[model samples]
Target: MTPLGVFFLSIGLAVLLGTARGSMRRLVLGGGLSLGVAFFAFPFSRALGFLSRDALDPTLLALVPVFPWLALVPVLGGLVWLLALRPQWAAWSGILGGGGLALLGLLAQAQPTQLVRLVPLYGLMEGVTAVGVGLGVFLLRPFQRGWWSLVLAVGLGGLAFSWLNTQGHLYLPKMVGYYKLLLPAPPGAEEKLVAEYNASLPEKNAVLKELGQPLLRPIASLRDLEGGLPQEAAEAGYRLLQPSQLQYGALAIFALSGLMLGGGLVLLRRPSLWEMGDPKAALILTGVLSTLLPAFEATEFKLQKLAKGWPFLVQFVDKAWPPNLANPEAGIFPLQSVLSEMLLTVEIALVGTFLAAVCAVPTSFLAARNLTRGSAPMRVVFAIMRAFYNVDRGVDTLILALVFVAAVGLGPFAGVLAMAIHSLADLGKLYSEAIENADRGPIEALEATGAAGVNVLRWAILPQVLPLFVSYTLYRFEINFRVSVVLGLVGAGGIGYFIKGAMDAGHYDQMIIGVIAIVVVVNLIDFASSWLRSRMV
Candidate 1:
């Protein structure tokens, strides 16, 4: 076999080995991760190969010799197995798959206009597929209980939400015009905007200029303008009003049934369907919400020029809020300005995570029941730390920043503090878990050797769990990186605030640049964290 083929084989064997041993679970994880890194390293697999190529003739491309599918089948199967087993696999898959498929369809099979028209359909399909597959795996796995359900729920919700955004819809309520409602530019601001528009208006007699005037079309009603939905969503140009009706009806039925199911369960003194570990029921409920919310908030908008042969209803949705197909108007920040904002975001995340990690180790020991020997005083102290963790984790960093901005004011300082507090709580929990899970044999043996509590902990517990703790810290840092950006939206200072500001200013191009930068940074961080964790633990 060729070097690439041999590498792929080794990766597969390693992953299978890791998956087999409970103690060596991380090994399987590391193996899977190595395979991904290797795949990307291949020149043929790089985006440049797929994206830069404009080969129209298969015969000509064949002369260059792309690797046959047989060479990569093991890699493909490995990825598929990972997706079926790993929660995070779905997210990356959706991003790559959805983006690639849409791009391919646009470049090869359909016009830009047609591609836009199909955005919602593709997005829905992707969401459904990811959720179904993930939940199916969850059903097959017994250990995924307790907090695992919450993790799965969040993952699925996030996927569906991401899918919705990909379809050109922000997937928000109709009333939420902009992510945050604008108060008509403070009255005089509207007049100023109007005057500005009029001054820049193309001459009415200019035919080409007249055509461009209607580029964005007007929303026919408040409903039409709801959440910037593309208006031309009539199935293949077939106009259908209340496409959302089916969604609404499903929501209504589910909600009613959920209520009934809950009530019946209560009356009968039994668990509800969701309580019965019914992921399907939970997913149905999730889907119903996904569908119903947009329908109820559908808006009406009027487009002057027909961008595509969209059904009138589809067009209405499109005009209200630009769907994933047609780009949203860039906010104030242009593409050029995105880099600075993203850099700052990454900086804040790294600093904040490091700070949190430093503080968490000590607190975790104090909070661990095992280390505390279940002593009442110690338990009480631990209880207090636990309370702090709960409260810190419960409130999202964004909200904390809102409060912190009022107390400490803006800038990265506020963001850092917010992230630190949240991370402390998170890391504390993880540390405690590590302490709890450590092999008790060595710890007990140390105590039997007449070692003091402090010495036992220092000699036995710390060494065993330090690696796990480090891994968790790195993991949290990666999360904090993303969270800090999100918090920036609320003016906590990061890329998010800039992106949000750009969106408010209707600078679509700038918004796109900011968003693109964020995606790239987050994915990079995720990759790094995965690699680092694999090596450490």
Candidate 2:
């Protein structure tokens, strides 16, 4: 009857399903039935005030009915319980339940003003589709059990989200029409009367307050409002104007979003490889189809028709361009400059690793029991070293960088010291493990040959532990490279500094290029380290 009651009843039924012998199948059916009803019915209930109540906190009340997808909490709670307590049901439940909640809440909030809110939902849908397509293509025996369940769970969830988004009525006054689909006005009816009703609403005052009076002025038509341009912009002396064509383009864009959204779902259900049951073809098809579908729905060409609509479509059209990578008249490659910054990052990592290795090896020997022996005095010494190692490691590299940066005033030196300190703790642990696992036979033989304590370690322990020590050092080196990049976030002089700078300037292309450079540099270091490890082995 009520939205809350309906949601609770659904949960009660789900619990009953969990008790059944074939629990997962029952859960699948029960969950679908409960969520399916609540998805559409809840919106209607909100409109009718079935769940409406006066608010204790007035500010929070504004966020409730306008965003009722909160019913998804129980669904998610059920899935998590199923995952941990009943692994068999986890695959389907986790994907489907998590996906449904995320999508339902997302689409319910999709007013013209809230379109940007769907970005993360779109991202989730993309992720779910990718995972489902991956599972369908790969038939690895070890992973098959978990993968199939995950795919089905995510698929069901995605479908629930898509269905709910399309079914709900737009909450913005009836005169504004739904955002995604434009309904035709009744024949011989005056559009002006509808516009007048829309102007009288509290929402118009709210919009004026948020957007400012000047921005809302000259909106004589729905086309003027949607397209964002006023007619006779020069004569009216308005700061911004949108052509009529752009308004239609905005409408087309929203319509295309719905189609693109639907096409992605259809692409997931179809099988591309019947012979081998390969899902790669299906996956590639989905990727190409979903990505390209929006391209055909271009709105930029309509910018010249500003009499009826907004110029927002021009923004999207500019995004479609490959980008003007040429220098801004300076004969300089901005990309190359960013790439050079990444080279400096590699330098910082290498230098820091070398310094850390030189310090960590001796400290590690102090922590190792083999070097100290089974004596109580030696154990106490080992304990102290271990305590010191953890303290050094426990504090994050960033804090260390901040501490050193404060002392030295922000540069690579602070970053290098931070990496060395963090590396000391990490390398100490690995070195101790290597010593613990070392062959005691060689150590015993040295003792039998009348070797002294230091001689035994030098002649027997060092030879056995050397390879392992090198491995740990190399691993720490890789970690150091990553740490150096992070350190650059605090002006430690690397690609991170450049990235932060680019982000601050709103230069996304430069930011992307910087990120690409960082990835390349890190990969190169990894490859070189692997080659070195091969030689060591």
List candidate 1 segments past 4 Å from native.
1-336
Instruction: Write the residue-wise lDDT of candidate 1 on 1-537 in tens digits.
Output: 232233334334433433443212222222233223222221111110111231111111111222232234235325532542443333343223222322321232121110111111234434555676567656655355756865775576577656555653545433121111001112343233334434433443265455665433333332333232222222222111121222222222222222222222222232111122222343444455444444543642224335444576574444434313223473332444567777888888888888888898888888787867666888889889888889888998888888888898878888988898888889989999889889999988998999997898889998999898878888888888889888887778878887788678765545666667778887888898889888887
* C-alpha lDDT of candidate 2 relative to the true structure: 0.53
Worst 10 residues of 2 by lDDT: 48-57
| Local accuracy of candidate 2 as per-residue lDDT tens digits, 435-509 | 788898998988998999889878888898898888778878888888888888897878888778766876666
In terms of TM-score, how similar is model 2 to the real structure? Answer: 0.45
Residue 400 C-alpha lDDT in model 1: 80
Q: What is the TM-score of each candidate against the true structure?
A: 0.43, 0.45
Best by lDDT: 2
What's the lDDT for residue 186 in model 1?
A: 29
> Stretches of candidate 2 above 4 Å error?
1-328
Q: Give the winner by TM-score.
A: 2
C-alpha positional error of residue 203 in candidate 1 after TM-score superposition, expressed in Å: 51
